[model samples]
Target: MDLDQLKTFDRIARDLSFTRAAAALNVTQATVSMRMRALEDLLGTTLFHRGRQVTLTDQGMTFLPYARRILGTAQEGREALRRVERGRVTLGSLRTMVAPLITEPLLRFQEVYPGIDVVVTEGRHTQIIAMLHEREVELGIVCWPNIDPLCLDLEPLVVMRERAPLVVSAEVAERLGPRPGIEDVLAIVPQVISLFWWQVEPDQASALCRRARSSVELPVEPALRLVERGEGVGYFLDSSVREGIAAGKLKEISPPEFGELYRDTALVVRSKAVLERPMLRDFALELAKDFRCMGRVIEDRLVEDVERAA
Candidate 1:
């Protein structure tokens, strides 16, 4: 009946445990139980079947969507008011893509809206999705093919796709010789530094991971560092390793068998209703514009590289 009761119900339903929900909501377990009991009494039905494992009853399942919608609408109203009065925008981004995707675009956003405050929270895909669902952030940048916005009730605003290249330290590249085949590269250096930020298929990803004699999984920054030290070869977004490649510290290898791999980064919002706010809309537009410009620059460079190779 009340927002607090509804929020408690929603959280409890999500976590499937009153104790866990209490921890997440920063309240006592007894308080969570009291709120849920009050809600179930008000509705004149048993919501959850209390037992060793917590499971939603038929009535609870029916009410879950309505509760989520009410909570979402309430949060959106609060955000709208905050946007009008304070000009604050919050964004969530994948930790690996932050440098390549966010830095320049954020600077551009700041230049256009100097008075507005922008907060960026970086996390992996699941964390970012949770932030969006909980209304902790107004926007999120996540890897595509890895995330399906429609299924998660998020609206995609922009998708920026870029090449993912196989790279190694200059020393390793020199050892393999120019125009090395996949077999030659594998024979010389069998260890691969794996980054799972982008994957077209689970099986394909697994196969790549298993190809090397040995593999070590790491986050983007650390993996890049290891590759730079000639610890192992890495498959990374071109933008992520561009500086290193240009500085002669890293080399990009394009073995004939590896072909081309691309990664897509998308900007998404919880709902299209959020975009009705002018300030948020402006910030979103600024980010999209910057990303488009970056895509063009990358494309131009690719064309130039092809012409020179020819």
Candidate 2:
């Protein structure tokens, strides 16, 4: 009936030794025995068999799962209390992907709920998702292809269509004897920038391979930097390169489809994570709304495509 008594019984059952359990609980062996006996007597069940080596009875085995759950609930309650006192919402994201994907929505959410402190941890995409699934953070903004079904609750939101362009600095291009073709640029750039090929269909994959001169596998943004600085023509997402192009630091190559690569963004959290915290829930909703509104950015283009058919 008493939690302390049940706790003592649980520890004794786990260790199979009253002496060890007593030492663990910082109590005397006789005190441990007394608590266990009291618990067994109150429940009218003989929890453990008396012998040279202790073993659980059927009733004790049945009680084990419940005991673990009760202790877990207590720990969770204590942790939640600590989180409330701290007034912080911990979030995680892939290092390079979070800025253009979630930063604006996060800022807007902060404006609406200024009292909630938002702490962000950045790592690789896989690491970020693992932390989210493990409840290390409240949420994760990820740009991965597909998520695992095991331990996560996902909110899929297409924040933006990311397109990487094959870019070259004007100064760099002018220095070359002849401008490279798209396939040629890709092959050669990998040598200088290291690149990951995405969205290249099987039909195009062969062509890309034939022309690839470089074997470096750099991430998108850094690859673009290599291009802009004239090290090589490299691929980079439009969101990252747009500013540089506007500033006349980079120029897009003639390959029309080179800028078409894209990935969908999603918010991920542990399946059991409670979205019950009012301020935290509010922030999540605001972030979802901001992402949903992204579709409106190309509304005019959709209208034009529709009218042209008419």
Candidate 3:
């Protein structure tokens, strides 16, 4: 009938002692007894058997589970209220991967849940996964292949996919000559500006890096700019260099060692997370939405690369 009386009865049933339950509940033993008596009166049944020690009678044992369920429901309702007031969310992302993968989905989310505050932490792919394991962040936008397959508690939603193109500047291509062998191309480049990746297939890029005369790791834009200046050969997402390739600023190079290059970007959450706020779940879905070859830079560039290579 009354929540307080039900709560008291549940605690007393669990502890099997009114004095112990009262101490646990921060109430006097008299108050606990009174609430238990009121609950028993409402139910019209004797709850506990009292002889030498306190123990639940048949009716009390029957009511125990139901009381626990009610208390659980109440706790959930309270937590939901607190979530509405707090409206906080944290996301982890790689420093170089945040541009097209992160921007639009967040814009769409803000249009709907403007009151919620989103904080982002930028780190390497390994660091972001570490943040998830530590429960320092609620969600991560990461390259899926880089994540360890053995990790059991990760839930990944593939948001978008783009091609990784092995590319050289037009000047570099001219100097190296048309359709040069992989070894000749490898010899000419003094420095290879490698870009950030989740490293699902590290061997593909690492092999090239190892074979090249020298290598420097850089982010997407800087890598692209340096490659355009003919600093050396580089790998870039097709979308990142689509405009350059179309405008004759960059050229695609195919080497024998590399095969089938693509990267899947994902929104990752802990498998055990409840996602109590709709904003969190909806944002993940938004990132996962299917955006084909129209406005998306990745799709547009992929088509161009295919036609040019054809």
Instruction: State the local distance difference test value for candidate 1.
Output: 0.78
Expressed as tens digits, the lDDT of each residue in 252-303 for candidate 2 is 6655433344444555545323455656655566556654553223211222
Q: For this target, which candidate reaches the highest lDDT against the unseen true structure? A: 1
* Backbone-clash count (model 1): 0
Going through the candidates in the order shown, the clash numbers are 0, 11, 0
Winner on lDDT between 1 and 2 is 1
The residue pairs in collision within model 3 are none
lDDT of 3: 0.73
What lDDT tens digits, residue by residue, belong to model 1 across residues 129-199? 88888888998887764454434676666767777788989998999988998677777777887777753
The deviation in Å at residue 42 for candidate 1 is: 23
Error of 2 at 64 (Å): 34
Error of 2 at 282 (Å): 2.8
* Model 2 local distance difference test score: 0.63
Instruction: Compare candidates 1 and 2 on TM-score and give the better one.
Output: 1
